[model samples]
Target: MERFYRRDFINTLSGVRNAHLLGTLSYKKVPNLGLFNSVTHIGATPPHLGFIMRPLTVPRQTYHNIKAQGHFTLNQVTLGTYQQAHQASAKYEVDEPEFEAVGLTPYFSETHRAPYVAESPIQIGLELAEEHHIKANGALFIVGKVVEIRLQSHLIADDGHIRMDAAQAVGVAGLDHYYRPEPIAQLPYPRPGQEDKILKPKNN
Candidate 1:
């Protein structure tokens, strides 16, 4: 396959992925926003999450800021803000923050220096926990422990599951395409000999 063809084809193989606007702050106090679809759940007990970054062959403002400040924010890109979130992926000067350029408001909490997207319904602040460089590809895997979560109280179910569909959160396929997910009835946590049982439908 051709270079661009191969890249585009392989990128979508994982299907639609959660898209977030990762917020960071440079050492000089410049706030930055970048759209990232590589964010992944690392664990639940300690509340850890991670995202992948490309190789350092080029300057990655997001990676640099996260390392310098040791903290960052992940703001869910909702249907209302998906266009602006996609615009954040554009290359901008180090001093030029994407929040301002893309017409999104940068919100700061009293405790964390990293800015969060005011328009995002679900925002999470995280502290750097670990980082690993992939030997084969030179990409970086950055892990963060959840520090703070901000969202509407009504979005959470009694069982602790978040109703992302209610939030209208958007997903990304390949690199540029965006999608909003619909809830297909939630299934019961499978148990031995309970395969036939299904939970009552709820917002998922």
Candidate 2:
């Protein structure tokens, strides 16, 4: 059976990709960045990632940053830096540096030519590859090609999986609530009658 919810169902979903995207302002000059909870990994083979821009919204700092640099870093938002992430999202004057506002440090990227939040534990370098507009809701859909991902050495699990439990990254339910994640399964999304195998690790 198919299921459906109000178009605003996203506002009710409990877990979402809330990240701190860092980039420099092209039009305004000073540092421009923001916290975006709408990011996702699109494809793994060629490493495509995606994020959305809510429609009718005036141009955003991070949007201008991407336009200026053609690159941005998706900093894994953490509890320690959630405050900074939230602070960075404020609509500050285009010329004002959000990092300066929060006293956070910016690290220059060697790969993508964009800056990332130095305080973040992990980050992904990305370059814009595709963009489309969501017609019904008027949202802007963007796909970024992953250039590189920086991660701490120990976050790797014994099976070589990203030990997200150790990463301490935080997610948002909507606009206000934030929480750490718990893993239920890794891969091989299961079908009915596959429950027993689903619970077992194929890698073993």
Candidate 3:
């Protein structure tokens, strides 16, 4: 397969993933926002999250800023903001902040140095906890401990599960294609001898 086709095929092979705008601030206080689809839950006890950074052969401003400032924000992309979130991925100069260039509002909290996307329905603030360098590839794995989460109180269910469908969070396939996810079913924890209990979507 050709390079571009191979890239797209491999990227989209895993199907759709929740997308987010990662917010960082350079040492000079320049705010940066970049769309990312790699965020993953690391742990619950420690309340940790992680994301992968591409190979460092080229300049990676987000990695630099996270290292320099030791904090960052992950803002979930939604139906109304996916376009601007996607635009944040464009290559911008070091001094040029993507928040302004992409037309997203940036706000800050008193405790964290990183900026947050005001338009995002779910925003998470984290401090750099650990980093692992992949030897096979030059990619970096960044781990952060949750510092704060800002969002509407109602989006979370009584059991603490966040309702992504209610948030209208956007998902991405490959690099550019976006999608909306709808809840289909809710299932109880599997027990070997017990009959499965399931709740189907109301719309279904």
Give the Cα lDDT of each candidate: 0.91, 0.75, 0.91
TM-score of 3: 0.93
Per-residue CA lDDT of candidate 2, range 1-204, in tens? 223444346575645655555555455446567777878768899999888877846867677668666887788888788877887777787668678798777787665577777888888888888889998988888888988888888998887777766888888766767778888766775578876664455687
Model 1 score (lDDT): 0.91
Give the Å shift of residue 100 in candidate 2: 1.7
Could you give candidate 3's per-residue lDDT for residues 1-204 as a string of tens digits? 999999999999989989999999888888998788989998999799998899999999999999888999999999999998888898988869688788899999888789999998899999999999999988889999999999999999999999999999999998999999989777677888664344455676
Tens digit per residue, CA lDDT, model 1, 126-145: 99999999999999899999
1 or 2, greater by TM-score: 1
Name model 2 segments beyond 4 Å from true.
1-10, 25-29, 184-204
As a whole number from 0 to 100, the lDDT of residue 203 in candidate 1 is 75
Q: How many backbone clashes does candidate 2 have?
A: 0
